[model samples]
Target: MTAGFALSPTALGDGFRIESFTEVGSTNQVALERAGQGDPGKIWLVTGHQTGGRGRRGRPWDGRPGNLAATLLLRPKVELATAASLGFVAALGLRDALQAVMPSRSVSIVPDGGDLRGGGRFALKWPNDVLADGAKVSGILLETAQGGRDGLAVAIGIGVNVVDHPRDTPYPATDLSAMGAGCSASDLFFALSDAFVDNLRLWQDGRGMSAVRDKWLQGATGLGSQIAVDLGGRIVRGVFETIDSDCHLVVRGQDGEETRIAAGDVHFGAVASARNFKAEAR
Candidate 1:
């Protein structure tokens, strides 16, 4: 176990165990490696410092000393597509966990046409980011390997900025401390583990995805607003319509055509609308 860190009783109660480390290259990497070696899963690999963590598309994820870097290894008896939906499950869990640790703050939801106010509101940015006061506070990454007893193992890696955040990023980022929340990495991890259990039960291997989708849409940012998705080779600009039953982002273009995108980087509000107008003007 990592010195001065421990999982809460609730986190370890539901057949879940943890392997804590003082420092590691990445919790996700360790989890995957263990799975390949015939580990039974239901284990969380956590570390105080992650030197080589990564985000979506292989972007380096900065993990400061007091931040949280953990990965849950699991072997679910489901198809690959169904297992992928667990990303949404993890996102919901992280959002819930953040709310559990943060102080009570009134979240104001603007009417359909107004901008979102960042008054300590915790919102989920599809498909794997948690925002606090309109800035990213956490991110989730899901990776799968094919060597477990069940023929597949999934590593759900989650990173949260507890005391510090990176400044040089394409989008805004913040930490719990910056948002007036006095949370510790261990405290957040406890809440996250419990929340993950609840949300995973709610997901029910994708059978309950509709419920998850509804809950996700409730706290989703930029819904019904102009947004842009960077699809690597091209960008799709449109109204952020809704995520489908399978959780694919449905974008409604200016021509009234709806396109469902599996993955992309999303830009919202003024940033997105301004870019859309500039593109049209060109």
Candidate 2:
């Protein structure tokens, strides 16, 4: 359980329910069905493990039971664009919660790159991916209802590799176990819940997103760094510059042009010189 929301019957709020199971197709899928049924906010689906986990752009991010394979269904008053920032807010909460249990593990933040920005100097790779040390440590996938006004009932799916990195994926991945991280899903969940609830209110007020935007830049792992975006079959390369609050990613090419990419697969480089000049980083 996070600081505010709980995973049991006692803490279930208004229409929110926590579904815990041994395995399932995906929490996001399950939550989507529940959301359509008019499920109230904070309905969480937790499995012992996710046999088939996924990230944005349909990339597979595998998850074992004990890991955090949770998704919340909510019909928020916030706009569709602002809903994307929820991932950053959740990441910050998870990072902070992890620190409380393992204070000596060198949990550092580096804005220019090479560390986690504790105070939130990290950059956001649009759609959903958090960069720490130029490598992806956490990723988020937000799907919306897609109608105007009542348009975006959302399922903010977050996947944090708590135990190990992915040897199956082309992109470099790391897990908590590899990073020597040890925290319960319950504790992390509670922390995440509290973080979301706190930020959700900010989002409701519209001020939440502005704060989210600034924190994202601070915790940003890829701002001012070069990278590429692969959408459909076309590939665009440039120095990854900024992400607007609406979650639009702006990539600046060497030709001194800025490209606004709405959706694509993002790649980051390990070497600055090699990466900062229009190279694919996956």
Which numbered prediction scores highest in TM-score against the true structure?
1
Runs in model 2 deviating more than 4 A are 1-17, 99-125, 131-134, 146-152, 205-207, 270-282
Top model number, lDDT:
1
For residues 1-282, write the lDDT of model 1, one tens digit per residue. Answer: 224556667667778989888889999999999998889889999876788999999989999888899999999888888999999999989888898998445564422223653323787777878777677888899999887345889999999988889998756788898888876888888888889999988998779999999988888877777877778757788988889998999999999999999998777665566645344322
Taken over the whole model, the C-alpha lDDT of each candidate is 0.82, 0.60
What are the RMSD figures for all models against the true structure?
Answer: 3.5, 4.8
Alpha-carbon error at 182 in model 2, in Å? 2.0
As for candidate 1, its clashing pairs are: none
Candidate 1 wrong stretches, greater than 4 Å: 1-3, 104-114, 117-120, 275-282
For residues 170-238, write the lDDT of model 2, one tens digit per residue. 555565556555665666666566555655554553556677666656655556666667776666777
